[model samples]
Target: MNAIAAPAAADDNGLETGLNATLREPISADGTPVLGKTYTVPARHGRAVRVKAGQTIRIANPHGTQVCDTWIFNAEHLNEFLSFEHTRAYIDRIIPQPGDPLVTNHRRPIAELVADTSPGVHDTLMAACDLYRYRNLGVEGYHDNCADNLRLALKAIGLRTREVPQPFNLWMNIPVKPDYSVEWLPPVSKAGDYVDIKAAIDCVVVMSACPQDIIPINALNPLDVEFTVLDPAVSSHS
Candidate 1:
């Protein structure tokens, strides 16, 4: 097993730190209400990020029910990235322990379940919400969401649109039954509780604070979330 270490504090450069006060952004229910202080992350699933080794990113769910789909890619090589299939297989192989590490197909540690404050487990099978799904699900008007967020993140990083893949839904509640069936329900994340993870390799962390009101994932009122970067004490190699 890969050794885990405590997250380090950030210096003046915002390199290593707990939650940076200056970096926090407020998300509002009405998208237009957000002024200069807010970073509008349109709903787009399958967002990806490439954080360098030894950097930790914190995704703050300021509002309770927001769903953030996330994925990470190595800064050096995007091909060897997080595989949802591998992650699901790993989870199935394990005993469903609370804090087990989710390893990637390359046998590299992807992210750790540092905290699961919610009762419902996130969905690995659920595809990122898209325009087509919205139309098919009877919520066609709200076509753009986390999927758009992913596209924006990719564009910011200079990656083509086709590179984005299926992501891990952060706060979305996808319940699995003993009979192997699944149901989508209200999200379980509370304000301030976040899914924290230290990158195993130099990778970018992409996320979309979901904006879907038709579903209860955002409690019928989608709110905003905050993202902060923390510094790691040990190198990725160590």
Candidate 2:
């Protein structure tokens, strides 16, 4: 029989690695939002909202410089989430275009990129920033980070994910160089630019206005972003 190595001592519980305001506020008790109302994800904070199948979520870059770290999870099964690796393979591109299907770890379409008002420049390669990342940057005390924001956001809405998957970094530019290196650059999107993601299945969408002041990303000034859930029926009925 083969021997299995025991895991190292660590905080493995699916809870917030640390705390922040993201734990206090949820768009709603269960992460539900008004059908057509816009909600703000404050700078250095995160928010989660539920999107039903056939509904679309429009995330706006009011400042254009703010980077939004995004994630989508199947409402029924947290383990099934939008997987960038699978999505990149599914779409045959690292950056998904407006028409591309956002695929999940199960190799199924969980959401579709319905519209993109800005230049198609988003990142799928970088892990969401964490407390350790801040520590490495010489930040003392607690720092608000996307990884913890994700955890606390979900926890705020009575949900938890065992793993923190790589997020779809919306409006986050990391251009690849000729030598295969990448540069973290500011977003090219302009104010009012937005992307609309339509749910292929019932899912929860989370957004973190990345708090990375140490880097050029977010233009070194993290700011708030907004989102709204658009119900197709409303437009159709009106």
Instruction: Highest lDDT: give the candidate number.
Output: 2
lDDT of 2 by residue, 20-80 (tens): 7888889999999989899999999999999999899999999999999999999999999
Q: What is the C-alpha RMSD of each candidate to the true structure, in Å?
A: 13.1, 6.1
lDDT of 1 by residue, 67-89 (tens): 77776765566565667777667
CA lDDT scores, all candidates in order: 0.55, 0.89
Highest TM-score model number: 2
Q: Give the C-alpha lDDT of model 1.
A: 0.55
| Lowest lDDT 10-residue stretch of candidate 1 | 13-22
TM-score result, candidate 2: 0.93
The ten-residue window of minimal lDDT in model 2 covers: 1-10
In candidate 1, how many Å is residue 37 off?
13
What's the TM-score of every candidate structure? 0.69, 0.93
- Candidate 2 C-alpha error for residue 111, in Å: 0.3
